[model samples]
Target: MPLAEIPLCVWRKRGQDFVFQGQAIRYWVAGQGEPLLLIHGFPTASWDWHYLWQPLAQRYRVIACDMLGFGDSAKPLNHAYSLLEQADLQQALLAHLGVDQPLHLLAHDYGDSVAQELLARHYEAGVEIASCVFLNGGLFPETHRPVLTQKLLLSPLGWMIGRAFSREGLVKSFRQIFGPHTRPSESELDDFWSLIDSHHGPRIMHKLIGYIPERRVQRERWVSAMQRGDIALRVIDGEVDPISGGHMVERYRQLIPSPDTVLLPGIGHYPQIEAPMQVLTHYLTFRDDLVSPPRKAACS
Candidate 1:
């Protein structure tokens, strides 16, 4: 008997090519109900949500798109990529998709920062975000431990590093963030490498990583939105992730008011890939709790 192909291949086939800012943005929309937008992290694309797409789509309209410089999207040279620009791309894409109502947000990695920006917009009544669930990500830069490659990417030598970076180096760095038990399989890693290598994606590493410092500069604004907003918010973390694991969760609890957190031991940065069901459970619980009417007090 022959082995079956990876599940993400199905998504690749289902994805539609959409236009955003004259760039061909790769996107997938499935299921039907309240919109649940899945925002992916840095260096990876919407495929990060492949594991949970079908299951989550069962109950809600699930939408995901590759940010301008990622996945099957256009990767332009010498272009500046900022979190604000990423956020703008998100808004445009949603409007194009006819998402007029507020959206439920599930974000990971760099996408978490983008979500924070959207949260701020909601705070000002510029946009509406129904709720948000943050996965393993650098919500707090102080708590974030950027790998050496990330540091290099943010430095003046970043361009040279991006140009010289090899697939093996990327794989090694990627594996370093996963827990020992949940490292991605070889085929999965190959898929990631292929996405990054597409349209010379690696060359834009420095630009995309500019979000790190932007997080620090905009901390007060983004954090304030999460703390003061009416939306129900949750943070689910992979405890063993070296990047933003337990330590980030600690900061989140200390800083965010009435913090709701789920800690998964032995998992890593990519919880969706490592522990898909657990992530889905937490997500659905949060979504359901928000939708369910408040419990009425029993008669005294």
Candidate 2:
């Protein structure tokens, strides 16, 4: 599939861009009400949220961006990608959108870590995150199971391995993560492969995988943000996911105070795509709970 002809590109019409530090950053916005920022995972761009964008947009002003190095955003070769850098880019995006009011957040995979960094800024820099919900992601490196290709791409010879990365590997790795019942179609795979290979992105895959180590090194800072109570937070997980699904949820329950988790059995890593309606239901339920009044104490 040609990048421009992908489903997300064709369906989406409100796309826009802004230059940040001399690089063009692409973002999409639609709908109205309180702004809801959606951050996509690693190896993909804002298009990952395509399934949830319209529905959620009907209820909230939806905003999503192709974080630098992915999708329509500028991919600068030899540039280092980090959670903090992405978070900063997010900040810039919000600023460009003129979103000064408090906003809700929904993130998945690499995007979850980016959300954590933004949450931390909520404390350190007073960036108001009204609420947050995390989908399958490696919040705790210990629970993360990176595929063999991921390990190789992050290895010492990663530079060479990244150059040699193929569409076959992309299909195999992506397919293996989804549940047998909810695997993405060939069209979806083609779009994904096209996005990754766009603008010579595959050549820099190794550099993008750098987040695997950055996660461990910055664990204290990010995990602390997840554990804090200043902001309401919830986690929706795909139980069958081998990467950051069941195991990551287990760690979340163990560490987060008053943790809220939704388990989707038989589902895999990308619940937002594989089980979007279910994910949307859980998301709205979480948001409603955050705003709903607590029940009055029973008369004694």
Candidate 3:
């Protein structure tokens, strides 16, 4: 599918739009071969894939979109942001692009929730997904350890906390989850703050964070998606993350059959950003295994 030009053009830097339910969200598509969809975490835009985008594009038709209410997309204050809607948005984007072929998914954090929802839908008659690769995320709500700030934001007075949210608070929260050796630098933190500065904090954060609790309510559907063997699965995680670190990986091994996992010891949350090359290696290895011919026994 053409990445641009119906009413707007799509570019790596100046991305174009795809309207979903009348809301225009930014999306980027590049390269060729089977499609590979990238879904980013909460409070961060699709720019999270910048580190690995070009390299990945070399092998597959890489597609990424800034979900509604995130990035440069229209973040209406009245918008009802939920993982269900986000999953629907992804399916719609593929359909709009006329992608009938089985595609792949690479998702992180909140995007994990969206991916799980899509995986559940995979058992139905719809867009066929070849496989999925997960980064650090709360696949199991029981294991997720939201920081104090996140907990406060989900509280009754979250609006008040949101009003008081500051860059310092964000920095502190980020540093907490990130590995001690891999903290966000000033410039990087600035870019992150800028993206969410307006939409982040305030009631917008409160609304967006609703996904945390929703995870609990729909825990069965999502967690079960992982166990169903519906699609090939791989998890590349930052083991040190206080949120869903190595512990989550252990849980996955216990639940998923013959789980495929890559554990980055020093990395924290944001593996693609912190350890781009490593994440790329593990991801490509997994995808390659999917298409490669199985090795046969030597002739006697």
Best by lDDT: 1
Off by over 4 Å in 1: 1-6, 292-300
Error of 1 at 254 (Å): 0.6
Model 3, runs deviating above 4 Å: 1-12, 198-202, 293-300
Ranking by lDDT: 1, 2, 3
Q: How accurate is candidate 1 locally (lDDT)?
A: 0.86
- Write down the TM-score of every candidate: 0.94, 0.94, 0.91
Model 3 steric clash pairs:
none
Candidate 1 vs. true structure, TM-score: 0.94
Better of 1 and 2 by lDDT: 1
Model 2 Cα lDDT, one tens digit per residue, 67-116? 88998788999688777899999998889889999979999999998888
Q: What TM-score does prediction 3 earn?
A: 0.91
Pairs of colliding residues, candidate 2? none
Please count the clashing residue pairs in each candidate, in the order shown: 0, 0, 0
Q: What is the C-alpha lDDT of each candidate?
A: 0.86, 0.84, 0.82
TM-score ranking of the models: 1, 2, 3
lDDT of 2 at 16: 88
